[model samples]
Target: MTGQLTVTVGKSDGRVTVLTLSGELDRDETHLLEEAGEAALASGIQLLVLDLRSVTFCDSSGLRTFVHLHRLATARGACLRLAELHPPVSTVVEVVNLDRMLSLHPTVADALIL
Candidate 1:
């Protein structure tokens, strides 16, 4: 519970920043997620893709972070997307119907293609 969340970010095509998050995005880890997301947006990256394939659990905090990131991306003339979400994270996104506002892909490669 005290450990830091692992958020790995990489650049692609000089325009896309892929942030791969592994581990739970709970209260203990939300800050890290937000920081990573903000950093990507701050870098002037036009496309932000979050790879949550390794995330086994997500709560309201995680969902809120995504929403906040979406706004950040929009303000920066960029895009924020979620990819490879496991059932738990996917459920939160679906219940909130964010799928309508944001893009969700089955894989990172798919998101990049978008």
Candidate 2:
């Protein structure tokens, strides 16, 4: 709520990186997401899962971060999938139709399988 953010990186069953995000995602916090994604890509992780179930808020900067990550991942022959976006974040994704542009799953398990 106060623009705070946290990112937890973990490995799923497959060779995928799962980033669990909590709290607000905005200009002040997007760096965390960017760093996690970039590090995963740099480390040769082709598949990424972003679990945003605990996210409380997100701004345009957060959206931009996601879009940029998607592009970077693609260029690196990687993929970024999002899962469990909170209501606020989900609304923004839906309004911008990013739900169509990005691979979105209802759960982390679902993203990991795909």
lDDT of each: 0.86, 0.89
Among the numbered candidates, top TM-score falls to 2
Please write out the lDDT profile of model 2 over residues 11-88, one tens digit for every residue.
743468999999999988999999988988888777988999999999899999999999999998989999998699
Q: State model 2's lDDT.
A: 0.89
True lDDT of residue 76, candidate 1: 89
> Candidate 1, residues 59-113: lDDT per residue as tens digits?
8788889999999999989999888987988988899998888889998889898
lDDT of model 2 at position 12: 48
Report the backbone clash tally of model 1: 0
Per-prediction TM-score to the true structure, in the order listed: 0.91, 0.93
Best by lDDT: 2
